[model samples]
Target: MNSAKKFFQNLAKYLAVALLVFIIVSPIYWILVCSFKPTRELIRVTPTFVPHTVTLFHYVGLLKETGFMTYFLNSIYVATGSAVLVVILTSLAGYSVYRCRYLGRRFFFNILLAIYIFPRVLLLLFLYPMFARLNLVDNLLSLVITYVGITAPLNVWLMRAFFTSVPLELEDAALVDGANRLQILFKIFLPLVAPGIAAVAINSFLMSYGEYLFASILIVSDRFKTLPVGMAQFLQQYEISWGWLASGSVLIILPPVIAFAFVGRYFVKGLTAGAIK
Candidate 1:
């Protein structure tokens, strides 16, 4: 009786998990399928679960006609640049908060956290005037700077948490062996918290890549527009280009998905480590 009950319980647990996975993945699968379906098939009265006629027309049109490649490259540049800056800056800040015995360190950390209290639109309103004065309003650099600013606070907090999780004994031992501050930081602390850095990098990249609000407002030039803003061209005043939109969505989401796939383990470990600490 006990064995039977345990088996039944396990079966129920697996069933529930399968259901949740299906719910989460079904939309993504549907979108991928739809992107390949021909326009006529797409608008059929009876929706096809799978495309009967798969074609690359949407993808080809998206690439050739709509300046998709330009937007994609621009997005890659901004996202990669912001991610690198965020990781470097946040790692330094996190280390400072962890190691330095300074007055009001706690207050400083709190101030960083306080940045999130204000809405992004409100921040952008203030930031736009400053950028305009500096002649950075329509530049890709403006997007990079804005993304870094928005993403840094949380990353700094996460890095600090990761730093705290490292034992002080390691630093002390390195110091005893005549390792200088930079050496100790590079050789000891960094490797230990690598997962945290991976997590931070992924977060920053995704945030900057998909950010439409700031990108649209800051970038006026069609050539400088990122993927999100460029994709919005499909939405005309009258008719929506559902095919282009669906194909664009698939492409837009691919990078982040691929990124997470590679570093997802580290990302999970980093978050759990920070949470525990």
Candidate 2:
């Protein structure tokens, strides 16, 4: 009787998990199906769950007819630049805060947390005028800088937590062996906190990649617009290009999905390590 009860319990858990997975993946599946369906099928009174006729016309149109490739390249440039800057700056700042004894260290740490907690809209409101004054508006560099500033605080905090987990004894031993601060930092400390760096890089990249408000507001030139802003073009005053929108949506989500698949283990480890410390 106990064995039977255990088996039933396990079956119930599996069923619940399967249901959750279906709910989460249903929208993605719908989008994929719609992307392949023709416009007539898409706008039909009765919607089809599965496409009878698969078409690559929408994807081809998006690439050739639209500025999709330009938008894609712009997004890649900004996101990659912002991620690298954030990781480099945050790693060094986090190490200093964690390892060094300095004036107002606690105060600086508190400020970082406060900035992270604050609403981003407030910052954007203040930053827009400054960017305009500096002629940074409608530029890719502007997006890169804004994204780095927005993502850096949380990443710095995360890196600090990771640094705290590294053994001080190891650093002391390195120092006694005549290794300087930079050598110890680059060689010993960095490798141990690599997972944290990966987590920061992933977070920064995704945030910049998907960010809509800043991208839309700051970038007025079509040539400088990122993928998120470009995708909005499909929804015009008269008609919405559902096929193109769906296809673009698929492309937008693919990069992050691929990135997570590659470094997902390190990302999870870094986040968990920060939480525990």
Candidate 3:
């Protein structure tokens, strides 16, 4: 009877988890399905879960007609630049906070946490004017800088946690062998915390890739606009191109999905790094 009761409990738990997953994933699945469906089928009174006619019309048009490729490349540059900068800056800062003895180290970390508590939009008030003065207002560099600022504070905190998990004995041993701070950081600490670095890269890239508000306001020239802002151009005053929108959405989601797919194991390890030991 106890075994039978435990079996039913486990069954119920699995069923609940399955239901939650379905609820979360069903909308994304619908968008993928609709991206390939023709306009007539998309606008039909009755919804069809499966497309009777699968067409690549929207995808082809999206590439050929729109400046999507430019926007895509722009997003890639900005996001990649931002992610790299964030990883470098945060890893150094986190390591310093973890390893160094300083008077205001706790105070510095508290300030970072405090900055991260506020919405990034609020920073734009000061950021826009500063960038405008520096002639970076319409530049991709501005976006990269903005993303690093927003992503770095939180990532520093994350990296610091990872840094703490590394035993100090390793650092002492490296010092005993006459290795300098940079060598210790590069050879000993970084390799051991590689999962954490991957996690930070993914976080920074995703944040920069999909950001719309700052991208829209900071970028003036159509040529330099990121994917999110460029995608909004599909919304004309008269009509919204649902097919193009759906197709674009599917394409925009691919990079982050691919990144996570490749590095997801590392991300999981990063999060659970110190949990067991």
User: Could you tell which candidate, 1 or 3, scores higher by lDDT?
Assistant: 3
Q: What digit string (tens of lDDT, one per residue) describes model 3 on residues 117-222?
A: 7776788888999999999999999999998988898887666557787899999999999999999999988999888898889988989999998998999998
Candidate 2 lDDT, 158-270, residue by residue in tens: 67556787889999999999999999999999999898898889989999998998998899988998999887864563377888888988988899899988876766776
Error of 3 at 260 (Å): 0.9
Candidate with the larger TM-score of 1 and 2:
2
Pairs in steric clash, model 1: none
lDDT of 3 at 172: 97
**Candidate with the greatest lDDT versus the true structure:** 3
lDDT of each: 0.88, 0.88, 0.89
lDDT for position 241 in model 2: 86
